[model samples]
Target: MPLNLSQYLHLRSVPSFRTILAVSVLLRVGLILYSEWHDAHSVVKYTDIDYRVFSDAARFVLHPTEGNVAQGPLGKRLGLGDPYTRATYRYTPLLALLLTPNEWLHPSFGKYLFAACDILAGVLMHTLLTSAILPHADAHSASPARDTDKHYARPSTPPSASPAASPTRREQLAMLLAATHLLNPLVFTISTRGSSESVLALFVLLTLHAAVRARWAAAAALLGLATHWKIYPFVYGVACLGVIGGERGVAQGWRGLVGQLVNWRTVWFAVVSAGTFVLLGAGMYAIWGYPFLYESYLYHVHRLDHRHNFSPYFYAIYLAYPTHYVPSSEPSVWQRVLASPLASFGPQMALALGAGVLFGRRRRDLVFAWFVQTFVFVIFNKVCTSQYFLWYTLFLPLLIPQLSMTPRRALQLAGVWVGTQALWLSEAYKLEFLGQPVFFGLWVRGLIYLAGHAWVLAGIMESYEP
Candidate 1:
């Protein structure tokens, strides 16, 4: 039979995943090669700041002797000091170890590694969507129930309380979602520039996949490794706990409620997660020692760089910054407190915990809870960056398929987010690149951007099926 216009257009809109993956890989590899060529040839060379740090760190990891790094050409050029302190390498030694192979292959080999992980993450999400993990409503009951002993129990393929799209529809949606993630400018740029968000993304997706499959040990281990890799992921431990607590934990009575949380499973999950995190930390300490403690993890807590940031609190941090370095300070204690990195602690934790309680029970497969939690955490975070956006956006494709939002609404919200970013970036460029005294103006713009972010988040809340 001949295909109608709508069917043809729909088919065109959702291309084959294999084709999409191939194009994505080729584009990333081609971009890496072109970038290297341009950097080598052009007077104005483009380089990602962190890529060099990653490369240098990997080199230092291979030859860790202090005299060797200080004497070698690599050390002379990159100024390789303590691996953690050198080139601002604020990461676990694992990344340096992971990327050392790239040094043998090519300088840009790390970019290829990041890109491969990026595509693989999308592939994994698509695979899970098509599998029995995120089973549609027709395949299983949506409502939660209790076993004879009042233990929380539910059907194998249950989605949120709502009926899910048919399997065929979900497959198409999964394809489109995977393609969206692969082509998203934010995700694409990060991987192209050799950021490890893709690597982190793979662990995150794997943890969620394992949790959804009831493989508690695997989930906990992956989650632990992820948390060790990036401190922020530690917050998602709540969501993982929710998975172990109960898929739905029937809300019929106190017995079901007791079974939901106070159980062996939750304890085992916590123990394994904590154990894995401790082991990784101990290993890193043995290799890198005290400096690793300060640079990789501790530095983040007290870090304060108020020079051109997106947070509205930057102005406060800036004012407080001057008081610390001066021999004599006259600013009030309140001003000093504002300058401290801990200023945003209260709201960040409150909102994150609130999101966890709010979204824990209702999930689209397994991501809705963590997605909401991470979104709340990043927006309210003291230090927000482009890579921070990737934390939550990683799961967006999976969540979007289950959202009640239309394509048009999603596009509009996306425009709002982009427009706010553009507004902030324009001001940022003026202050940073043009040497303008628009600090106050930029702070106000940050406030506007914060409002824009909150507006977008509210829309997401409204559209969420749960």
Candidate 2:
């Protein structure tokens, strides 16, 4: 049976922005209480060591450890240490600087700070959805007069009896985006665990927001900072460039590329983006020298820590080169090059394929392409961790409004995503924390995760009513 007008209105009203914020604040308070009590049963008990690493690095930044020049040119320590005091920190220097305030304040300040960032991200999601994405989605369904006024006026009240006065599809979607961020389990987990992905996620959304507004310099600068924090964000450049190019009505050929290259916004974007990366890199190198550069940047290039990572490509790497799975065994170069699995080439292939897709849809809305780009970025990454979902989950809800699926279909797709994650985590936890021969189970989980995303992507593509 079809939902009646009142029933649909009730569903729409449930995810109102005010309701989402209230629930979010309450959830954060609960997390804070749980954190204060140090409850073992709390979900944060299985917190990622990445949080501790951030705190330690920031602390080191606040107070440098004394050492000799023999370690490196940077005075005492060769690198920042982790929770166990191991010299293995793996983030850019800017992140440490960003978190230093948490160190200066109370020990628990960092968790609260991350929680605040998550809230900020939700706000940004609301703005992006309502101002940038939703208006266009509504334009297709409503009269031009209503569409133009949708943003200028406050959200229209739910329809009384008049069908024309009903809450537009756009308002419902904006609420959905906010609700998804506020209630997302992954956001809660990452915030409670002190994952720095919160900070990165904020920058990512801000960059998209800027891109949507055609504030090219702001978009580029934000993307640069985000890319500096994590190399994967470099792929975001494609979305920004593609969107701006399309907006300007740049043609789909080499002539368009040439024209866009000379555009003032394009030139400004390129300059600021490159300048940020170079200046930051130079400043960090000046402060810490070779060790800092190697530990922060080069380490990732050679990182082969294949222990319990959630990448779909890992299973192929494990099967083809089983010796890499052996803690004591070092795979030969041939094994790494020839026998290594999907992620070995996945990023490049995904980027290429994504570029093709985005460029082909050169006339599609920039926001849609941005979500697609970032989603592909995280999915095909060499190291897919639980926290990595934050890279795109916040953006996916914003894109959902544009997809031509019914509410039931949307719920079903979300179920596929969440169900796959639940199944994968069940097996992953067994292999990661428990001593179980769940190696094959990990493979199954990877296949399922990969398939789920593929299905979601296909649905989005197929449902492109625009």
Candidate 3:
């Protein structure tokens, strides 16, 4: 018999589900209000404040002809002619364009704009994960064992052993993903702040979704915008290219890979992406003048060498010999070579390329490869700030349904999330203890925080098989 619509509605309207949804909405609204209030309280009354540095940079790009930077003309009026020196401000011209409308509003208003973007990004993430995981669950007829197998398999497939399956298990998986997205502190914080991380994350999710659907042009365009906002997203193209190539191979698994990449759509995406980047760059140069653009935009890419050495290995080595070692001032040839050693690069690239080489042979493995490639780049980079966690946050939720997660593992992840929030809030509020050493409390909290993250990352790697 067909299920009654009224009955289904009654079941879904159960107190638990409705209560959870209500709580999620309340938490989101509360975080947004808190962030807005915090920024307002921190305001310097008649004077402009220096927080939200990225937003300020965006405003500068939007009004380059006015000889302004991201912080606005208020800086000039206050005789603080150069805000760039006080903050690291660099953003793509496209992002600047997005912030143009907000530039006219008060900085507090800009905070709201950022918070809105965060909420939208979270919604999109939920939708993408739902779409991505539902098919596998349905194929298993809602069998938990089959669902578990599919989660860990390379090329997830329907159980030929049982053709007549149900949708109960699929519904369960969707609920879990929704719960994770709603409760994850990292996601909550990013969404509520006036930061570009959430927007970049939205673009990342869009790019991945487009790629899966074989919408090459749309994917490429989304990727172009993502890269323009932050350069990290561009590296994902390497993984995508690998997938395309792998789809064409046969005996060597080359046939399906070659066919996917040589298509007209892929070609169009490439062309559009190149053109978009060039046009955007040219526009910035024209408005800001080459000198200002070079110093502000180009300089960051060139100056990455001298930044803090944030890799685990670097931190370990530095701590072992604190007084003897000094951080490099710029990217010297040796520093670049050491930072991205050939040995590490070769293996990482091989894994990405190899995943492409074996594309349809294992669908689950391909996603894992892409995740590992991105993770390695971020974790081993020359600078590892707390904010850098945003990159991992962007993709980790998508992998939850695909991994062999246990209740224990889930609890550990929960613990790590809570620890991260405590550390982040402490840092954000500049909380101090007893004022013995001004930075003492922060340093102790930071060490504990990094250790917690390291534990979670290790757990993830151990759980991964492909």
Evaluated with TM-score, which candidate comes out highest? 1
Q: Candidate 1 — what's its lDDT?
A: 0.72
lDDT per residue (tens digit) for residues 1-466 in model 1: 1111112235446778788898888888887888888889988755577888898888876764644343333334554444664668899878887888776888888888898998899899898777743454334334443333222223333443333434555566667768888888778777877788889899998988887677879988998999899887777776666555667563446676456656788788888998999998876675566767777789888888777677767777876777455658577788778866667978888888666654555334357778778887887777776678888888877765445445566788899998998998898898888999899888898888889988998887765544
Rank order (by TM-score, best first): 1, 2, 3
TM-score on alpha carbons, each prediction: 0.85, 0.80, 0.66
The sequence of per-residue lDDT tens digits that candidate 3 reaches over residues 1-466 is 1111111223343334345456666776676667666656876332123235656655554444334433333333332222233245555444445655566765455445555555555565556655654455334333434224443433333454322123443344444555565567766665555555666766777777787776767777787777666666666665565555444443343565566555664466667766665666565555444543655456654343322223333433333332434555444554445444442445545554443444323333435555665655655554566677667655665665455555566677768957765764555364333333224444455456556766776667655543
Query: Which residue window of length 10 is worst by lDDT in model 1?
Result: 1-10
Error of 3 at 301 (Å): 3.2
Q: After superposition, how far is residue 20 of candidate 1 from its true place, in Å?
A: 1.3
Residue-level error in angstroms, candidate 2, position 380: 2.2
- Which RMSD does model 2 reach against the true structure? 6.0
lDDT of 2 by residue, 1-466 (tens): 1111222444435566877888898898687667667645665554457766777777776664444122334423444422212256777767666677767676666777788888888899888766766665555433322323322322333334323233464456567668778788878777876777788888888887787777778878888888787777777676565555556565667777656545676566778888887777776676556766777777776555456566766655555456546757786675667454344556655764465345433423655665566666667766687667777666676766555545575677778988888888899888778878898888788778878986986666555434
